[model samples]
Target: MRIPANRMPTAAAYRPDSRDAGIRRYFGLVQFALIVGVPASRLCSWRHGTHIWVPSPDIQVGDHPGWSMACIDAWVPGGDPFLRPPVVQFADTAAIRARYHGMPASTLWACIGDGTIPRPVVWVDNRPGWLL
Candidate 1:
């Protein structure tokens, strides 16, 4: 039987029974980085620090092992922030320009780049697209 997407078990629920178990559920650094909204470099830094260490799984992927999503969830519990709708008012470059009455997009981007205006909370198609 096929399980519904929403009702499917989380990766943690499928933890292996033994150290030599053939099956494993884990998230690689890239996957974890995407989930956390930070760059992979930052995630690596966290791993290097004493506070965070990605959990090692019994089953390895290639030569490197990955962390169980369940453990990561326990370490940092929260829904994916990126998927959530913006909590504050936001506008795209065009909207922002219109709102500012002919302010150029380049100027707005420069301001955002230099931390003059708030940095974008969301990215759209590789472009900053939010206001705070």
Candidate 2:
């Protein structure tokens, strides 16, 4: 049925049949970055690759790159995934001394006192340890 000219629907009320209401079908650059836990600038840089390896965008609209919701779910950053902090390996004085070729306990203590050796990063079971 044809609507009268005076009853014409406004643009805001128009819904294109091509877009399904089931769920969001696509992710904008900003939205993808937010879900991936990175800044939009970083995403753009990664898409083009700031290093030897770069993640390619899943979809492109015009000159801008985008991703489908499905692709976003599977998205992995260029290096070791995005926003993943590096694992810190903690070792106590004895273990640390072993790493330094078994430096003497007295020498290690002197270094610690003289500020040559950095402070411990964590304490477990009342033992101090440095991050390796």
* Top lDDT hit: 2
What candidate 1 gets wrong by more than 4 Å, as runs, is 1-23, 51-59, 77-132
Q: Deviation in angstroms for 70 in model 1? A: 0.8
Q: Choose the strongest candidate by TM-score.
A: 2
What lDDT does each candidate get?
0.52, 0.56
Candidate 2, residues 1-132: lDDT per residue as tens digits?
999977854432322236645432334576667666777788777666655233444433323444545456665665444432233345667876887789998888888889988866543223455655
What number of backbone clashes does candidate 2 have, counting pairs of residues 3 or more apart or in separate chains? 0
* Per-residue lDDT of candidate 1, residues 51-121 (tens digit): 55543332333333355445455455233222222223336566666766778878987877898777655
Error of 2 at 37 (Å): 0.9
Kindly report the root-mean-square deviation of model 2 from the true structure over all alpha carbons. 21.7
Tell me each candidate's RMSD, in Å, in order.
17.5, 21.7
TM-score of each: 0.33, 0.36
